[model samples]
Target: MNPSSTLSLLRGICAAALLATATSGGPAAAESWPTVPDELFAALGLERDVPANVLYDAVAARFHDQDQGYGKGKFADLWEPIAISRYFDPGLYEGRDNLDFEVQAGECASCHESVTPGWVHSWDNSVHADLDAIRALPEDDSRAYKKEHLAEVEANLRSMGLLAEGQPLATVGCADCHLGVNVKAGNHKTDLRLPDAAACGQCHVRQFSERESERDTITWPQDQWPAGRPSHALSLQANYETAIWAGMTQREVAEGCTMCHTTQATCNQCHTRHEFSAAQARKPEVCSNCHNGVDHNEFENYMLSRHGIIYQANGDKWDWDKPLSEAFASAGYNAPTCQTCHMGLHGQPTHNLVQKVRWGFAPMRSIADNLDHPFFAERRELWVATCSQCHSPSFANAWLDSMDKGTEQGLRVVEQGNAELKAMYDEGILIGQVTNRPAPPKPDEDAPGGFFGLFWTEGNNPTAIEYRNAQMWEQQLMRQFKGLAHANPGGFTYTHGWSELIGSVAIIRDEATRLREFRELQAKVRELENAADR
Candidate 1:
């Protein structure tokens, strides 16, 4: 049988086994049964006094069904996660729901110290394992805002039966996660490696939820398609192709854009797996995968800024693993990284990147339409507060506002360039063509009239010549948005982006007009020759 078919058969067998066990009994504590409504047991056709072990087995069938759903979520990485979740929920854990796993954490550490020394060392120093330094800060400390998020994480875990609600929450230790009650010591048969982002979501819920959220592909990225511009397949949740190559949805960019999108999740996109070090996560390089190069060059733009220069100069001496409680205090570090602006020690340590920007790269629509709106206002407020940590509010706000206006100015320039392209397209000069390649087969060759639209629309021509025309159109516009957004005014702004944008539009129009006139002259010659022959 085929691989997918074989995997499907195996899953069917597992479900059958779980269902057989579930029909017999489930794991339910007897003393706790009295608190439950008798109607619940009646619905299942079970006795009210069913033990927790019996109740657990009876629910295994449903658990299996639920586990199967993970293999088919929107995320591209689900196969391993579903299998790992089965290990987490053989439904065998039984004991008090102790939230703090300090003693258990030590036991977990004792054995792994020899094998994974580096990972063990990283985990020991990780914020997940300890936050004592943060707790030491005074109650009024601003950076301690992460405490509420941590508490919220513990609460979410407890509600999901992963942690105990009664005890005080601490930094999530290894034991809190590997919480299997009957898991044996030196259990050589069991797999301890559960690195699924879904598993982590029970605790770290917010960021996990945000991984495949809509904001990921909100506007546009480098659209040099058919000429091959990079795109976020997972984030955009679409199949895309380009001129030079194809794109993959997998974490790795294999085979140079041959476009093989896979079932990989963006969960470990930032946090990574295993040791899950906050120190590594805090680095600006983490944001580079999705936020760099071509049109979206904020990460590169930042490198050109004074902040990048400072980090390059004196960052090695600075501590990256500073506690949340002290992060806002700004230890004697000379420069800031991308994290300092977006996820910085501002009062809020959030995963929402949009909260840090007022103008962003594409404020064309937002500035004109939603400038004074609440969402835009809220974002500016957050940015102002974050910037105020370093620069004075007046200085920061004025600087940020000037950028917003710059973006607005950039949009006006784009509108001008757009008008030039629209005129060419409307005048039977720059024709509509599919940007995708291996371009879809051309519509009826003898078709008479032209279609109005050019952007991924039906009934449009798909010629190599047209594809080149579209590429010219797509790339020139990238400068206006990409340059203004990155704050890199030299190359991306006037030099390459906006200044060249106007020039490119004119060149395309002139070429398109030349092509149209040549075609007309050829048709006229054909007409004269036919009349002479008649």
Candidate 2:
């Protein structure tokens, strides 16, 4: 037979089988569709009146029978185990309904054999297979209970939204993320999968909600985007810990696990292709997609630092593959990636999904100060162990101290400059008519311009002119300090130090104008008095 004819026959057979199964609702149907418990069904917005047996029968037949005609053969196989594990798991069904038992016993093994044959054997080795058995132990039991307790420790994930009424604990499962309610069928269907953001938000509601809230407040300069795209890392939450420490409230961190793990875009946004790989996650460039910005320019800083310079000059002479260890010397490596100091000398347990890492980018007032708690106590030992890979204990301690002293000195200088400006302003040596005494002036004619200067003269008021000049000096000092701390020459000049210096000069100019106005007013008053006396 021709290839086209053969393909046509297969389609017809599949379609006919699906129609028969949907209408007939046979034994296969009964066993294929595991009925959700009343509470679960109600939570999912299914009909409570429909008998569990009937629903089971319909779903089973629709899914399993060859004649029922869903064209997704391999796709169905990939989907079934995840669906079963997510929805019909033993714990979720315990008090709700025993209907799943009948369906699971009679049809599950056989149907799964057809759908995902390899998974039948693999399921025995899976973490999910024994989760319920572990959860059944007494709370004090160390062996089994410890695992359960650890899983529930909450990771302090941020919340995004309230749980739908009757929805299970916001834990993840294959079907929960991928499937949707079949409104027409009044049962779950594999159609219309949730968007990645929404799927992740089901558990990570706090982080998701926080990101939305911060979106407007955290803005990027228009020049940052050469092509008119939004600035990198402008949203803040793109870097998980930075976002939280920067300003996110404690309330935003109380949600479940999904919030920070997922992003507005799909996983592939950073990981590239859909088949996520460990190798891709390990690269520094992957993080640069969002982190190459003014606040957290890890990529740019790393490149300019000694670590990045060496990596650029040398190829793969050092071991990039191994976790940082005593054998992994920086002498040979020359330079390091961001993974060196923050992650580890050679990328240790810092970024492990299963375990938290202690070392982090220390939060700062101006990216120069050290955070109060540099080591998250929960993972402190783990981080110290990673440091042991390169430096001796004394060396590491000394290095940290040096870094702290350097940062503090820079900040002190800036603070001193600010104090000087405040003192100058207080003395009133420089004076001005402060049109807008407390706030910057509005860009309107309410304070009239040259065209209507005489008519609007009354609105202008002489205020503390020297004080404004001091304020400008304080701003410049802040920029200089921030640049010195980060060791970024460009950041110090353009973004921090120089920009503030210019602003201070502008304030001085404004103060000078105010002083001139005061003198002019005094002269005019004297002239008027002399005329009256004459």
- List, residue by residue over 339-385, the lDDT tens digit for candidate 1: 66665424645444443344443345544556576646766777677
lDDT of 2 at 443: 23
Mark the regions of model 1 whose C-alpha exceeds 4 Å error after superposition.
1-160, 163-194, 205-266, 344-346, 356-369, 412-479
Lowest lDDT block of 10, candidate 2: 227-236
Each prediction's total of clashing residue pairs, residues at least 3 apart in sequence or on different chains, is 27, 29
**What's the CA error at residue 530 for candidate 1, in Å?**
4.6
Expressed as tens digits, the lDDT of each residue in 1-534 for candidate 2 is 998677646744754454344323221211222222232233234464443333333333332233322222222322222222212121111222322222212233366678777755544443333545544655233233224222321221111122222232333233333442112221223232333432333333222222222222222222221110121111112222222122222323322111222333333334343223323444567666645543345566555555566667773565443323212432244444544444432243222121222112222233333233432332334434544564576755454444445445444544444454444445443223343322222221221112122112232222333333333333334334434433556545665555555555555555555655776897899999999999
Best by lDDT: 1
User: Against the true structure, what is each candidate's TM-score?
Assistant: 0.56, 0.37
Mark the regions of model 2 whose C-alpha exceeds 4 Å error after superposition. Answer: 1-277, 315-334, 344-347, 352-388, 392-395, 416-534
- Score candidate 1 by TM-score against the native: 0.56
